[model samples]
Target chain A: MSNAERPDGWAITSPRSDRVRMIASLSGRSARRKLGMFRAEGPQAVRSLLEHRAADVRELYLTDAGTAANPDLLALAAAAGRRIRRIPEDVLRAMVRSGNDAPAGATGSGADGPVSPQGVLALAAMPEPGLDDVLEGLPHGPLTLLVLHEVQDPGNVGTLIRAADASGAAAVIATAGTADVWAPKTVRSAAGSLFHLPVVTGIDPERLLPALAEHSISALATSGYAAQDLYDAELPERSAWLLGNEGHGLPDAVLQAADLAVRIPLAGSAESLNVAIAATVCLFETMRRRGGGAAR
Target chain B: MSNAERPDGWAITSPRSDRVRMIASLSGRSARRKLGMFRAEGPQAVRSLLEHRAADVRELYLTDAGTAANPDLLALAAAAGRRIRRIPEDVLRAMVRSGNDAPAGATGSGADGPVSPQGVLALAAMPEPGLDDVLEGLPHGPLTLLVLHEVQDPGNVGTLIRAADASGAAAVIATAGTADVWAPKTVRSAAGSLFHLPVVTGIDPERLLPALAEHSISALATSGYAAQDLYDAELPERSAWLLGNEGHGLPDAVLQAADLAVRIPLAGSAESLNVAIAATVCLFETMRRRGGGAAR
Candidate 1:
């Protein structure tokens, strides 16, 4: 069908169609990089894209039920003059399956299942801010940056983004080896926070260090065995907190480059906290120190 | 083979055998209730059970590799005069599969996949502490308790327990609608903290309130929209913090019953924090207030 020929808006029916396959391919890193776009599924993420980053949204796909369920999103997309394609649920499901190897009808509830299709999907241009852009865009207040080094879990990466946003962080820098922040799973877990702040990805540690120094942003590395407690450490007005991988933690070279090492005191017997939880604790501690404790 | 007849110390080879079936059935809440036992899988959980709660361990199932890898656990079980049954990897895999309906030979990496067999399993008597028992066991210092109201995710429940332990909470109380604390997944997520503190499960809200009052412990309920911010709220020295379900925050009855409703201030546009993360933030904030900031 021609782009404007559909009588009742464009409808995609066949899961095996060329367009479906092309959309499905975006799930992979290479495909996303080549296409310079990523998919954001579910109402919340799509709404956030349309509302905050509408200029980046390329296409919107929705099931009939999805359209009915998300009136605000549909209206917002219409207001942005974006095309909306109504797709069958099975076709949407096939798109999700192409990206992930989850069993048919998995619904995203299972532990290893890819995130649920959530009945709506949008293709959007990937945001690729440079490291200099991130450092230069800092607000006038004390800068708080979150630096994630080699953190592998998409959920953890996304949660850190959300936590960073909530803690009033100026930006997030994901160094080499971190999960793709624009990946669908990360987008969903981030809950729209990805659009709120500057996010620079694929940065090397060597490049990241000098930029922080140039900006006078002191970097603090989190370690379970560090002698200095987080509360006791002298947090800088402008600081970057370095978080590491889930299993092995930050490499010694990264820790050595940090301005200081800090630990959260554990009163109980847990060997350690989850990486995301640890970052939240540190981020909020910094916020608390800056008199960010008063609530609205 | 008879229980005492195996020259190799009673090895189970068949997945359908009665012993294997019984051990696998403990994955269900009804089965655990009827059998008065639950399964703990993986080397860490089994080791914790042997080292801390050895008296409650009824049987230890291990593969040849598991036995070799966990000599300290074997010694502890042997010292406790517990029985050990060695099984092949397939039998352990089958036991996990039977309980979780994961595809045959599915090594537990999928979303719905049960935890991997981890080459070890142990059947232990359920630790069913009474509410009175939990209250009485609080340390002489100011008491800190965690009350989970109908929280359903096994991982979240387990993580909360671990966090509670790390924050030095005296005990955890899981109300009727909460996930089974002894489930294999929860046990794995808790990372052995289950044995480090008193955990009381299945207590009704009515019973919990009177117990808290009788102990002179104040209760704080967490709400995302509470008028009082968590930072501004005067957290009691001896208090029980109530966390609600994943989808719904605390029920109105529970909130109305609380001494105060407190919220964590969010500076960004994200709607809310994950339940477990919220609990950790609150618990650690309480710890910081108690001067638990000094690390070893």
Candidate 2:
């Protein structure tokens, strides 16, 4: 085996190096857009990126500990003929953006030590899946699409993406006001689900509603005050589950535009479910009605 | 009106006062235990605490903005014979611990501004509900209990508590190693559900399992790899849904002790669901089988 192929060779040790700073810049929305790349940090996300979207990965870095811990991931990347560079702890830490993985109120490398990226970081070309293309590719069966209408929390967006993937949704459509799907916090919270399905972002509601109508997909608005109970309603064969902002729910116009406003039954005194939880319940209920896990 | 009853007659303006520092220390686990008090920050949590558990609240503080924003809350507190004090923004900020209310990486009042507590904060004696008393009070009909087995994230713990309340669970029990139920982050994430149901913490599995049996409440372990599908299984009328740690999952011995092992069906390529999502799915499924929204 070549020395270059060994885990310890070709280390990047400087925290302030130009290349490390350039990679770290991907944490911000503008930098990602300018560079045409987004970052996937932590072991689970990087492993998924390598396994599912290996060709799109522009660069991969791992700390010495990261390399030792993820032998299988290294093997997978190597098999995919991807280059992996070993970086020092500081460099890896430098590339990590303060996000969901670190506890809140945690400042830079204080008593709790450095904020970790879980040993792996990957920069990949952001996949831009258009709504038209996503609609065109649907199979001839009951299909589900998860829509985020101005859901601003990055962590909630990421969790919703994972829920959409778990429930076998065809795609995730994020409105313009939604948190950047590529934000570091979203990527960390997504836990590798981003690589599993088509994610369309930055589309306006005006554009999306017409597109759904054109595609013959029913738009179901989830609300706490709706008259229709989700369980009692007859769900459409193909539908888009619309979840709105965390504080203010879907606006009146949007709710009116939807084919139906469905409310998840809150059995107790809770005024509403967390937007992410509400979305998951809706998606999973669709799965249950169509068929059980076997249908997936 | 008396000077004390008015919102702005007396104010706390100093962030470094002994009172502010003492309240700030409640953020630590040891301080909370030692003082037998925990904090509820932000408008929603404070409102819920006052409306639902007014007697338990020892003190309440609100900024000018908070008072202006929540006139109805003030009336509720007054009606309940609770004292409400006005504090300046700096003092309010000082009393808030580094928690979920603040975004990650936000250092002490840096470029993005101070970590806000959403204009209000409260200190309350923690409610210590016993497992035996909770079990004995269950209705004769179907009942649900949510169990967190060493789930460590404060945000996830809080979200799970909210989900349990939404699903009409009888109580939420946190085993040893779970996040502090009264931590600021958990309370914030819970949104207000903490006041709606009994939450028992610092429990051990050895004690929990026997307690469930005595109550004839089936213990259902939720796992990603369980043989029995959640939708397909014949669920018990009374049961405790067991959710394990984020990284390690439920210990094997606990899984063995469970009356049944249940798995939520994942239709997509994702290997598992988030712990909060998994617990919600299970709790909601119980509600679904018994009836729909009317069951509550």
Candidate 3:
């Protein structure tokens, strides 16, 4: 609905308002980097931010319908002592559109347009956890750390976060050239696991690998050409899986540096699994071996 | 590049040409149904079709650069005795756009636009395997059959097909309301697995469950609320995993109809795993139990 037709008490209605534009600008990398903030859209992500990292949420915008539909989220934000602004649908749409990197004149919605935020969006401070902090917090026992090397798909990055969280990983690390874990698509696809786990970004693989070894986390990589089968590989007590880019598998240098390279054992004609799928298989295998498969 | 700038060797240059439009029309469900054909975009999918299902391939379209970049695919297609039509980039783009379900005027390219075909597309007959045929052909020993009930995302459907193939399932069955297995996005996300295995579509779960029972294939469903843990469940000799929709999951009736309901045991706060991810975990777990995880 247009802003003019909104009922009373709508705090924001104009899509062109400065506030909306500012939130929209968060869609760009430079803007997010400049502001040290990113946009988290959809009720699931906003709710996650409120639940796990409420202090990081800078501004919360919800449509009247969104508030009505997600009273529990509203309560969580209230409990966090955060102010909630009710916006008109159009304003929310504008904010969502601005965050969308789609070129101008794009008309598709859902399948083609920017993700539908489900009437909720949040501008939150990016959590900048250092590699040292992540390492320090690591448990002495068996643990898994997912390392994405130049993985460019935001969806893959995000889904891997959720998978890691599901498989009970200690943390996720992204090397240089990987998709920003804080990107809107990643946030949505991650389905709020970004809040559940500590994610460190921007480390160079060359440096990250050796640093991980210092922590006793053996680096593991997957390859289609590898002779070692994943099921037979003896996973280390502390493991760091090194996932490569989408189009190219791990670079030779990275693969060479890996402690071990194993194949997932494709039974069919598919050359490989989606990066996330392959990672999950490895992660779950680690979990099962570490006794995570037992009933909690 | 514009069609006018292309060399004269191009067989098709005009996007508006009747032949181009005919192929473009296949993007729509009705058109695909009417023609009994579907378009498989990108070199990976076309290569698989030529390699595994060559007799089903009706038309092959490639660009000059595509031919050079994917000589192996070109060679495979030629070996299949299929005619290769070299089209200009504009024609390829137009065909890609027509297959895209994006609304008119949507300008986004990769992230927003329809998926790029990666320099090759093929028109091929849809493989219509029946449920009984799928069951009859099932291996007498340990086997897996992935069943999708009303799952609607094309990418998820495609990925599940690939996951099932990777996990070495006997076949994949989709219920009514599920995304069309032959859709362009499904074909792409499925990578080449669409041609690797038999997929039977449009079976009612209520009927499908009992039919599988008659064949001694147990029906299993995954749910967050289930009392049974997947890791401990006594997996049947012949298993069929029932996966629900992306949003609603399995209906109560379908869930009740299944022989067993087990949870994947989320370690974190994620309400559930993505349908494809969850399905893969189950498929792989079953594989692991049936000795599929052992080195080939």
Instruction: Please rank every candidate by lDDT, starting with the best.
Output: 3, 2, 1
Best by DockQ: 2
lDDT of 2 by residue, A86-175 (tens): 777777887763322333335322112123577888889999988889889877668999999999877789899999998889889999
Residue A11 local lDDT, model 3: 74
Expressed as tens digits, the lDDT of each residue in A1-296 for candidate 1 is 12244646547779989888988787677888999999898888888888889999998888878877877776787788887888888888877654444455342223344556567899999889999976887765586889999998776788899888888788899997998998766887787888878889999999899889998989999888789998888888889999999778999999999998998888876777777878888988888777764321
- When candidate 3 is compared with the true two-chain complex, its DockQ is 0.42
**Two-way TM-score contest, 1 vs 2, winner:** 2
lDDT values for all models: 0.80, 0.82, 0.83
- In model 2, which regions exceed 4 Å deviation? A1-8, A97-115, A294-296, B1-8, B97-115, B294-296
TM-score of chain B of each: 0.92, 0.92, 0.92
DockQ metric for all predictions: 0.38, 0.50, 0.42
Model 2 gets an lDDT of 0.82
* Whole-structure CA lDDT of model 3: 0.83
**What's the true lDDT of residue B230 in model 1?**
82
Count backbone clashes in candidate 3: 3
